[model samples]
Target: MITLQDLRKVYATRSGEVVALDGISLEIPQGQIHGIVGQSGAGKSTLIRCLTALERPTTGSVVVDGAEVSVLSETQLRRARRRIGMVFQHVNLFEARTAAANIAYPLAVAGVPRAERATRVAELLDLVGLGGRGDAYPAQLSGGQKQRVGIARALATEPAVLLCDEPTSALDSATTRQILRLIRDVRDRLGITVVIITHETSVVREVCDAATLLADGRIVESGPLADVVTRPGSKLSQALVPVPDVGVADQRTLVQVSAGGAQAQIAHALYAIATEPDAHVVAGAIETLGGVRVGRWHLDVPDGDRAAVLGRLRAAGLAVEEDVA
Candidate 1:
């Protein structure tokens, strides 16, 4: 539902022209929840702005729902933007407006009838699990409640694509999970495409069907969760499925092995390691992502046995990374 072709954005600064995006080309299919993750200054925000036509790219095209967003006329963009809904990290609801009224604001702006707006607002309120809280003001609601209101408001217009910018960054872990589940629920119900921009790896792991890692305005890695996680020595793999730190003898060589897919594959990997007398498992983590069970293990082995252990792990269908730091 979204396509970015050779996208590039440059900024004029006092020092010089700063390149915020560098040749970023990506495609997100309809009804998919895609996550864009990176540290600050990685152009994540710039990329989202480009998608919304808020920040025009210096070069290349931005297409959403078949609209060439980057080149749209101002009037055209205003109309085209109706197909894109935005959810901010901060709820940004009007303080004086009740939750229901906040949700009605978008419809109001779009010239929706008051009676129709009321009905839509009510449905959105229930959709985000804020059924009766419609009457409450922002001040009276909890952080999670406010975000729900934000989500409801974003969905008020039933946009074809939902753009979430750090949607769960301000919430606690438990609340974050709740919001993530709500997003997934929204996707399942509406079948709209979702693009979540976040710095948190946990958010991507918990909610994204596919994820892209950005570094210095370039894509470091991008793919479905399963492909990225199971890739041999993948940077995304290391970040998403990190093995815990364990104190061990420095004289031993550390080898990291990861496997994703069937339960039997993980079991086989474990058995292979267990059967090796010289391989001592120091740390490990297992997680289910994209409906696949994936596991990563850090093993300490005698330097002389490193080759043999890696050979065995590879033979058992495990992706192995030797001499992991």
Candidate 2:
């Protein structure tokens, strides 16, 4: 539903030109929730701006739902933007407007009839789990409710793609989970493509079907969650399923082991490792991501037994990295 080809964006400042995006190429399929994660200067915001035609790429194309948005004329771009909904981290709602009116604003701008706007706003309110709260103003709503209103407003135009920029960063843990679940529910119901831009890896782990990690204005890692999380020693894998740091008493070598597959397959690997008397798990994490059970562990093993234990793990179909601190 979205495609970016060699996307690059450069900005001119007092010092010199700074490249916010460098050679970014990506594809996100319809109805998929894709996460873009990076630190502040990693070009995530620039990429989103480019995708929305808010910032033109220096020498690349931005395509969404089959339209090359980058080259569209202003008149055309305005129409094109109606098909792309944007949800911001801050719920930038008009303080005086009620939730229903806030959601109706987009439809109003689109020249929707007042009666039709009311019907659509009602449906959206119900869709986002805020049916009776349409009469409430932003000041009267909780943070999560205000965000729900933002989401409903974004969907008011029935966009083909939803661009969520830090959608859950402001919410508490429980509220974040609720919002993430709502995003998934939106995708499942409307089949709309979603691109979530976030700095939090936990957000990616919870909601993204696929993810891209950015660093230094370039893609460091990009793939389906299942594929990336399972690959041993992958940077994205480590970030998403990190093994906690735990100090062991003895001076034994630490080996990192990981595996991804069916529940039984991962369970089998765990059992095999359990049978090794000399190897003790120091830290580990197991999670079901993208329909696969993925496990990563740090094991403390005697130097003399490291080779044998690693060999056995490899033979038993687990990826192992030796002598990791």
Candidate 3:
């Protein structure tokens, strides 16, 4: 539903030119929840703004729903923007407006009729699980509730694409989970494409079908969420799912193992060898990803037996690495 080709955005400062986005090329399929993640100053927010035409790029192109947003006229862009909805980090709702009124605001802006706006507002409130809270004002609602109102308002236009910028950053863990679930529910129900921009890896883990990692205004990695999360090469993946502690004791070998129905066998063999008093199982962790097993273990043994022990481990149908003397 969205395609970016050689999308470059540069800025001029007192010092020199700054490339906020350096030729970022990406494709977001329809009906998928895609995540863009990075630390502060990663150009993630800049990229999102460019996608919605809130910020014009210095070069390249942004194609959304088949229209080249970069070339659209001011009037054309305004009309095109109506097909895209955005939920901001701060839940930018009208403070004085009630929940229902806040939701109706977008429809009103779109020139939706009064009766249709009222009906749409009611439907959106129900869709976002704020059914009767429509009478409450933003100040009267909780953080999560305010966000629900914001989501409802964004959906008021029934856009084909939704852009969420740190939607759960302000909430607690439980509330964050609730909001993520709600977003997923809405995506599934409406079949709308979603682009979530955030610095939180946990948010991506919980909600994203695919993810891209950005650094210093450039994309470093991007792929399926499961593969990217489980792969060892990604720093973002490491932060999201940390490996267990494997202390390297004296005379021990630290072996990085894969979790693939072989953990029990490896453990048993290690235990049998460690029966020699000077040997013992130190630490390990078994993690499953994409229905495959992968993990690491540390095993202590007499220095004299190291070679034999490693040989036995390999012979036992396990991939092992000798780490210690």
Candidate 4:
């Protein structure tokens, strides 16, 4: 539903040119929830802005739902924006307006009829579980409640895609979970493509179907949520589901083992690897990734040939890495 090719954004500063996004290229499929995971100054904010045409890229094409974002005229861009809704981190509600009014504001801007806007607002209020609370003002609502209003407003246009920028960062953990679930519900119910930007690995793990890891305005890694999370030594994997950190000495052998396949059962693999009678797993974890059972283990071999065992594991298509640390 979205495609970015060689997307680059540069900022002119007193010192020199500052590159906020450097050659980012990726695609988000229709009705799928994709995450752009990064830390502050990693270009997530800039990238999201570019996606919405809020910040025009220094170069490259930005296309959403078959419309070229870069080529859109002022009026064309305004129309294109209706097909893409945005939910901000701050909720960005009118302080003086009631929740229902805030949600109706978008329809109002679009010149929706009063009767139709009223019906849509009522439906959205119930959709976000804010039913009668729509009459309440933003100041009277909780943080989570306010965000729900923001979401309802974003959906007012019946957008094909929803761009959420740090939608849950300001909320508590429990509230974060609630918001994620709500986003998921929105996607399923509306069949809308969602692109969420977040710094929290847990958020990606919880809600994202696929994810891209951003660092210094570039994508360090991008793939299926499970593939990226279970990849050993990958930045995104390290952040989400990290292997046990083994304190290694030059003399001691610390071998990290990993394997993945839908057909290869973890139980069978555990029973099959018995190359050494004394070899035992010191640290390990087994989890479901992309509906497949995948595992990683840290093995400590004393008085044994570590290289031999590692070679055997690798020969069997398993990833075995020597922990130099």
What are the lDDT figures for the candidates, one per model?
0.91, 0.93, 0.80, 0.86
List model 2 lDDT by residue over 18-89, tens digit each.
999999999999999999999999999999999899989999999999999999999999999999999999
Provide the TM-score for each candidate, comma-separated: 0.96, 0.95, 0.82, 0.92
State the lDDT of candidate 4 residue by residue for 165-186, as single tens digits. 9999999999999999999999
Ranking by lDDT: 2, 1, 4, 3
**How close to the true structure is residue 1 of candidate 1, measured as C-alpha lDDT?**
95
Q: What global local distance difference test value does model 3 have? A: 0.80
* Quality of model 4 by C-alpha lDDT: 0.86
For candidate 3, list the clashing residue pairs, or say none.
258-294, 259-293, 259-294, 260-293
Residue 111 CA error for candidate 4 (Å)? 0.5
Sliding window of 10 residues with minimal summed lDDT for model 3:
254-263
Better of 3 and 4 by lDDT: 4
For candidate 2, the per-residue lDDT at 11 reads 96
In candidate 2, where is summed lDDT lowest over 10 consecutive residues?
Answer: 246-255
Q: 2 or 3: which has the higher TM-score?
A: 2
Instruction: Give me the runs in candidate 1 sitting further than 4 Å from their true place.
Output: none
Better of 1 and 2 by lDDT: 2
Worst lDDT run of 10 residues, candidate 4, spans: 271-280
Model 3, 157-185: lDDT tens digits are 88889999999999999999999999999
Residue-pair clashes per candidate: 0, 0, 4, 0
